[model samples]
Each structure stands twice: as C-alpha cells, then as structure tokens.
Target: MRRLAPLILWALACSAAAAADVSGRVSTAADGVNVVPLAEGSVIEVVLTTSGGEQVRTFAARDGAFALAGVPAGRHVVSAYNSRFVFPEVHVDVTASGVQAAALVFNGAPIPASPLVIRPAGVAQYYEARKAVDVVGFIKTPYGLMIAFSVFAMVVMPMMKVDPEEYREAMSSLRGGDGGGAVEQSGGGGRSGGGGARSGGGMQPTGAGAQRRQIRDR
Candidate 1:
C-alpha cells in the first residue's frame, strides 16, 4: 500500500497541472465590458471546445457570467449559444497558468475590443406571420374587381326579373337606331287572311317588278 501511495500522489499532481479553469462573462457588448439587460427567461449557453475536439458546456448566470472548471490546458474556443440571438465564436487560450482571452471573430473578421463578450449579431426569424385579409383594399384591385363582376353576373343577374315585352321593345329600338332593318307588311290577301310580312333590309324585294310579283302572290 505504501508503494502505491507515492504513485497515486504523483498522478494527482500531474492531473492538476494539466487541467485549468476558464472563467469569463458573456455580455451583449462587443468589448465584454458593458452588460446589457436580458429578457425574462433568457438563457445563454457557454461552450468550451478544446483543440482535441473535447467540449464542455455550461449556462451563464443572470449577469452573463460563466465558468468552466477542470478544462485541459491547451488552445480552445469559447462560444455562446441561444435560439433568439446569434453569437460569434471566441478564441481562448487555456494554459496551466490561466485562461487567456483572445480575439472574437464573426465571419472571419476580428471585432475590435471584443474579447469574451458575445453579443448577438442579429435576431433569428424562423417564421413569418400571415397578413390579415383586407376586403375593402382587395376590392379596389383589378383582380378583385374582375371577381366581383363575375359574381354579380353569375348570382345577381340571374335573380333579376324582366318583362318579355319590355325586352323585345328594347331590342327592337336598338336594332332600328343602328339602321339594322325595317319590317314591311303586304296588303291582306294571304290564304290565312293576314298580310305577308318580310323583315330585314336585304331580304325584301328590291325592283318594282319583284315588288309587284310579291304583292300578287300575297
């Protein structure tokens, strides 16, 4: 047991020397100095990624402060995550001495004076709200007007009543005003004791001889 005790102590010391603690504050400012007011129930997740593909995650406090203990000494990257906001990846160097804050980058460009501060670049919008329909405004458009006219023709016009005599008179007046034709009647001489009638200008007999013949036949 005594021989194993020395080996256990040496192993513990080496492990302690290899790991370090990384501490920083995640703020809404680029300089990591000014702290912004966060929304209620807002939670920011701080992640520490080592060069060896190891990751350690923790939540930031209400004041945006975070700490990851027992992180292996090496070059590492610190980043913040949230659904509502976008965060830039921060490069941090962790050694046996302490955690050294480095440049924070966004889109390959270094942000000046922004060390550990993780401000959101912009708000993320996953969905768009539907717009409410405006009946009056729609009716003012050309398509809407066309639809309204179609509805009026299909629904309202059929429900209306018209007198046959009035419709015939209106049609006759329209035709006469346009010089469409004239109605002519022969003297009463047909077998039915009624005058023979012809309609339309071109359909009637033109010459005097044809007129006399038509009259005699009638």
Candidate 2:
C-alpha cells in the first residue's frame, strides 16, 4: 500500500488537469519584431523535462502554437525547436495553471525570458479551443482549374467580415462620443419623422385626433 501512495496521487492529479489545456507560442522575436512563424502547418519537436525526471510526453504539431494536456502542476521546462533551420528555439516555463506569463516571443539566439503565462493552462485551452483556419475544396475541370487558385484562396482565407479600417473608424467615433443629444439637434428642420416613428412604436389610436395613444392598447 505504501508504494501505491505516489501512484494514487498521480492519478488524482491527472484527473484534475484532464480538463486543463497547456499550450503557448514560440516567436522568433517580440510582437511583430520581424520573424516569420516557424513554419506553416509544420510540426516541431517539443520536449518537456520536469525536475522529478518524469517521462513527459512530446508532440509534433504546427509551429505557431503547441499544447499538452493533463499536466500536473509544478516547475516545468518546455523546449521547442523546429526541425528546419528557420526560427530560433523558444523556451518557456509552466509554473502552474494559475500564473500569468508573457507570450513566448522568439527572435535571434539568446532568447529572452518572458512571463507569457499568467495561467499557463488557461492560455493553452484558449488557443486549442480556437477554431483553426478552414480550407475549401476546388474542382479539377478545365474552367475550374483555370480559377483553381481563386477557389483555393476562398477556402484558405479566414472568414472575417470586419474590416480593420471600419473597426478603427467605429472606435474613433465612440471615443469622440455622440456629441450629446442627436435628435434634439435636428432643430425640427425636417418633417417630424422621429416623432412619427416613436408614435408608431406606441399604440396609435385608430380614430384619434391629436392626442397620443396608450401603450397598453397594443
């Protein structure tokens, strides 16, 4: 029974972190510090070594981000290196599932340390839960082949409708505010369309003279 103590504790820990996701990105430099994403859809080697020398699991996934589930909390050293000679190595520490750290920004050699993980596990869960880019199918017919590139673009491109310019404009407008009362500033210049709309929203009496109708009649 004594030998089973550690095993039992391990089992419990795994169960606790089963729903926990642990992942992060390794950049070549700071945010937009001028480094390409390691590789597009290329799996890099990730080796995790713990202080206790546990046989940690490693996975080969796309370069932008990586994840490992069921991580029993402690000081964990995660080393990620791409197979191809492109981006530099990215090292990160998973102090636990609750510590907020910096995003692993990779640049030249001598990679600097960043507190990329406030809650390491939470960050990983967020990236993993995010839906990946979806690519659509293309036809092989002559006409289809002629525009196959366009079809490929349509599929590969992210379905984002919000234009950056429009979003910035809206943000700027909100910051400036609505300039107080918009309706009051209308100066009764135009026909009382605003009043008419409000009146329409309320119950307009069928045989009314000029008196406003009550809302309950609706």
RMSD (Å) of each candidate, 1 decimal: 14.8, 34.0
In model 1, what lDDT does residue 1 have?
Answer: 100
RMSD of 1: 14.8
lDDT of 2 by residue, 58-146 (tens): 55444345566655555555665554433332334454453233233343232333322211111112234666554343355556676
Lowest-lDDT window of 10 residues in candidate 2? 117-126
User: Which portions of model 2 miss their true places by more than 4 Å?
Assistant: 1-20, 28-32, 37-42, 59-63, 85-218
Q: How well does candidate 1 score on lDDT at residue 122? A: 56
Per-residue lDDT over 1-218 for candidate 1, one digit per residue giving the tens place of the 0 to 100 score = 99999999999999899898777776665444554566678899999898999899999998777888889877778888876667778777677766664666445444322235556665657889888999999999999999999999999897686778888888988768534332222222442342324334445546667989889999
* Candidate 2, number of clashes: 18
Q: Model 1: what TM-score?
A: 0.48
lDDT to native, each model = 0.73, 0.50
What TM-score should be assigned to candidate 2? 0.33
